[model samples]
Target: MSDTLRIVLIVASVLCLLFMLRKISQSKVRIDDAIFWIVGAFVLVIISIFPQIPSWCCDLLGIQTPVNFLFLFMIFILLVKLFYMTIRVSQLESKVKELSQRYALDHMDDEVKQDEK
Candidate 1:
């Protein structure tokens, strides 16, 4: 990558890191979720500073280009994150449904008792 491009990437990564930290501080983002983004931004800054690391990874993996390797790695990470988020959402939905059902049953029981009295 060109020096200019590397500098741009580093600046962007730093911006992203700052944004994540700000969001965490504001409670806009959960710490667990922010951790992934923070780590990703740090990795981006490191790779931008040491472009050779990606190249070395590409060579080790027999990949043709550093850019391709980075894209592939990023896609894999995003997919894993997506899968975990899906599971978490499903669990939350289930809990909500269960709570709703319990609440309805409790209310119905109270109404029935009042009717009997």
Candidate 2:
């Protein structure tokens, strides 16, 4: 790779790692999401420094080309992140719905008790 390209890649990778670390440390991030981001950042840094490893991995996996391996790895990690986010969103939605339902039920009960009095 050209020196400029390599430098750009390195900078971008580091930035991504920093972002992941920040997210992981934040209270807004769930444990599972933080873990996923951390693992993704780890993989990115690993693959970026050891380009040959991707080729070797491709060979072991019976993939046709080194670039294919890189692409596959990236795509796989992205999909994992997507799935994690989907699950997290689902959980949050469920919690919100449950809380709303509970609030409504309690309020209705309170109104009924007042009406009885």
Which candidate number has the best lDDT? 1
Residue 95 displacement in candidate 1 (angstroms):
1.3
Task: Kindly report which residue pairs in candidate 2 clash with one another.
Answer: none
Q: For residues 1-117, what per-residue lDDT tens digits would candidate 1 score against the true structure?
A: 678878988898889999998998899999988888888889988988899999999999999988898889889999999999999999999999999999999999999999999
TM-score for every candidate vs. truth?
0.86, 0.73
Please give the distance, in angstroms, between residue 76's alpha carbon in candidate 1 and its true position after superposition: 1.0
lDDT of each candidate versus the true structure: 0.91, 0.75
Give the true-structure RMSD of model 1. Answer: 1.7
Task: Give the lDDT of residue 52 in candidate 1.
Answer: 99
How many clashes in each candidate? 0, 0
